[model samples]
Each structure stands twice: as C-alpha cells, then as structure tokens.
Target: VPQDEQDIAGQWRTFVENNRLDAVVCIAAALRRGVLDEAEASRYQRPAVNLHQPWELSGLGQLHEAAQNADRLVCFGGD
Candidate 1:
C-alpha cells in the first residue's frame, strides 16, 4: 500500500481484524520515515504515534517467519 493510504483511519484495522490477519511494519523503515508506534514515540519524545493496533512494529525477521508459515505469500517491492 502507498504511504498516504497507510494513515487512513480504520482501513487497515478493519481489514486485518475481519480477515484474522496480522500486519507488521518494518521497524527500521518505519523509524526512518517517522512512523512511530506508541513505545517508539515515547522513547523518542514524540507527541504522537501514527502507527496503531492491528499493525505492529517489528523486525524483518518477523516478516520472514510469517512468510515461511503462510499458506500464500504475496510480496511487493522495488529494488
């Protein structure tokens, strides 16, 4: 999904919840782009966190694990 689409209210939450899916945000990528979760926000003394529930900030290892365990995997990226 596009970066702008990410901040849209409740879309990701509802989709993930309804589908019983898990979403992980890459920690390094998120921090680099100023997309912080609650803990990160507090640690960095930021006033707010844009990333919320139904979406968790995690390392790429989690993504690898998820992919390894998934029945189907669809990845989108550009080198």
Candidate 2:
C-alpha cells in the first residue's frame, strides 16, 4: 500500500508524533520490509539501532496481534 519509503516514513513520523505506543519491534523474518532508517544502512553488523524512528513502530503489530487472536475470533472472522 505504501508507494515509497517516504510514505511509510511519513506515516511513522505522524504516528510517533500522535500515538501512545511504547516500543518498536521488527519481526526478524520481516524486518526487511522497509522502514529502514539511517543507522541500519550504516551499521555493518547490527540492526541499525541509531537511526530508528525516534518514537515509532517497526513492524505490523496488527497482523501479529491478529494471528495471536486467531483461535478466539468472532463469527465475522475478526477478534
């Protein structure tokens, strides 16, 4: 859905500026799904700890939460 890196970056920026989320957690397998900040590009051995968006998310908390709630879904197929 995001057309470019900046689109998500902008969303991340807006989210950080507006939400109450506490931390960012990237799924090891899916971390490559964009959201790359400056540090990740520079760090040769680490997952760019420095350039991470100041106070934003890093992964799809929605999908993961949905999967966790899969067994307890309602008739509409949603938790």
Candidate 3:
C-alpha cells in the first residue's frame, strides 16, 4: 500500500478501536490494497461503504456511483 493509505488505515484503526464504531466507510482501493481488511469491517458486525472507483468516471464519479449502489443496497448518502 502507498504511504498515504497506510496513514489512513493507521488513523482509522485507532479511531475504530477507540470508539468501537459499528460501521466504516472507505474507498475500495484500500481494501484491494490490503490497507483495510475484513477483520476491521467485521469487528463490530457493522456495515461498510466500500466505495468503488471506476476508471470511466473521474471526479465525483465514484461518489455518484457509490450513492447509486447505496440506494440498491438500501444504504444512504449525502453530498
């Protein structure tokens, strides 16, 4: 994983452990890069917003896609 991803994972790990969050929202790239893992997602039996990034969509594309998927998945999103 890149240094930035490592940084994010480290920070989130601390936050999650400290607060015992019931869910997590993260970019799919982190999961694919191993920055985030299943154990983390399942730590609290919580749901995750694994935002997907498609090459076809540039800026805000992933966000839009995530929102659309969220609807299908019964999740919610905001601008």
TM-score versus the correct structure, for each prediction: 0.73, 0.30, 0.26
Q: For residues 1-79, could you state the per-residue lDDT of candidate 1 as single tens digits?
A: 5766665556767888999988888899999999999999999999998998878899989878988998988878978
Q: State the TM-score for model 1.
A: 0.73
RMSD of each: 4.6, 8.1, 12.8
Ranking by TM-score: 1, 2, 3
lDDT tens readout by residue for model 3, 1-79: 6854568656656776677643434435455554434454575464763332211112346557766777564545666
Model 2, position 14: C-alpha lDDT score: 78
Name model 3 segments beyond 4 Å from true: 1-6, 25-78
Candidates ranked by lDDT: 1, 2, 3
Q: In angstroms, give how far residue 77 of model 1 lies from its true place.
A: 4.1
lDDT of 2 by residue, 1-79 (tens): 5554467756776787688544454544333664445544454354555335454334567556866977774333335
Local distance difference test values of all predictions, in order: 0.87, 0.53, 0.48
TM-score of 3: 0.26
Clashing pairs in 3: none
**How many pairs in model 1 have backbone atoms within 3 A of each other, for residues 3 or more apart or on separate chains, i.e. clashes?**
0
